[model samples]
Target: MSHIHIPDGVMPIWFVLAGWAATAVILYFCMRRVRDVELGRKIPLIGIVSALMILGMTLDIIPIAYHINMSVIAGIVLGPALGFISIFIVDLIISMFGHGGVTVVGLNTLIVGTEAMLGFYFFRVFLGVFGAGRLSPGMSAALAAVLSLIISTCLMIGVVYISQINPERVLHVHKENPLGKIFSLEPEGENKRHKIEDKRIDIETFAKTVFSLGVFGWILEGVITGFVIRYVSRVRPDLVLSEVT
Candidate 1:
């Protein structure tokens, strides 16, 4: 559910590039902060987590129209810095394999990384608020997953808006195409020809589609994150607290 499956050439170049630049900046800061930490031991764990996320995404549930990303689980286990890096690497590998477009890799990373970081922080906050109980961690993970999906959806809308809304340019392109005839139909007596060419991209329609497909998946993601976090809290609480203090 967390992985974006949208194809290449769908989103505008500027939107993709902007997402990449933002991701790069965030990664730079994350790396700088973690520079003093011991990364040798963490590298193997990162690889394992990345592989698990990839595998989880591949095991899609039919009829759901979504795939489990396991990004929140990674964030909960690995902490934010390493989790972000792990997700970035995973997205890069997936893009190379043509699972998603190469151009939108940064956007995809941002969406997945956002889920990871948010899940990590939310888990920590929930632990503090609920006294580190098993159930509390689980609740945190669930909330984080839902929030991450909402944020990613909004980012996707922005991409769609930028790509689809260009009145004058669209008109110019329509003038040069055979499809222009469809948009050039003359108006009848009482009814005006609905200008398909001039019709604005409906943001509400986009939001509705995203929300329809995403809401249920978000709930399922939350449940999975919650269960995993609860188990981790019981078996390996130290991993959860290592980055907090």
Candidate 2:
């Protein structure tokens, strides 16, 4: 739900370059912090998580373009550093398939990876708050996923608003409901009237519209991630890296 679908040449060059610079610095520190033995252990896990995310992304729910990011689960299992690198790999590969523009891969990675890291840290926080013995791992996972997604959605809304992409161009309307078509971009000239109506919306309106759409997606992702994490925790606790306890 938080994925940026803006094509290359649409977003300004400076923002795209800044994305790359920021990602490079994160990768540098992550690489330096991880030990060789941990790296060797993480590579296989990274590959598995990356593949799952790619597959999840490729299979969208249509119209809404909603897909499971699975980034929170990845963050819990792989840790923030490797999770970020894994997201970079997934985003880059998908761009080659024309899923997103090549120029904006860096920005996409940062946005998505930030949520993954947030999910990881927030999972710990939520687990603590809910009380480890009182709350199951599944519930903790679900709560964490929702909180992380909320943060990601808000951050993405800010980025889009700041970029000044006409809210009219970025969103559309359906059946006379403005919020119905949040983030549903179409080819230029597809629906002039819809664009005209969208222009009437300000950034606050746009943010509210997108958040409404996001609520459903977040719930679905949270439930699925929660169950999956619970299963892994029960069957193979060693593979579950995050401190869900």
Could you tell me how far off, in angstroms, the CA of residue 170 lies in candidate 1 after the best superposition?
A: 8.0
Candidate 1 per-residue C-alpha lDDT over 83-144 given as tens digits, one digit per residue, 9 for 90 to 100: 89888999998788787888788888887898788778776776678775547777877787
- All candidates' TM-scores? 0.80, 0.80
What Cα-based lDDT does every candidate model obtain?
Answer: 0.72, 0.77
User: For candidate 2, what's the RMSD?
Assistant: 8.8
> Can you write out model 2's per-residue Cα lDDT over 14-113, one digit (the tens) per residue?
5677778988998887677664444666788889999999999888875556788999998888878888888899999999999888988888888899
Best by lDDT: 2
Worst 10 residues of 1 by lDDT: 184-193
Candidate 2: deviation at residue 105, Å? 0.9
The stretch of ten residues in a row with the least summed lDDT in candidate 2 is 180-189
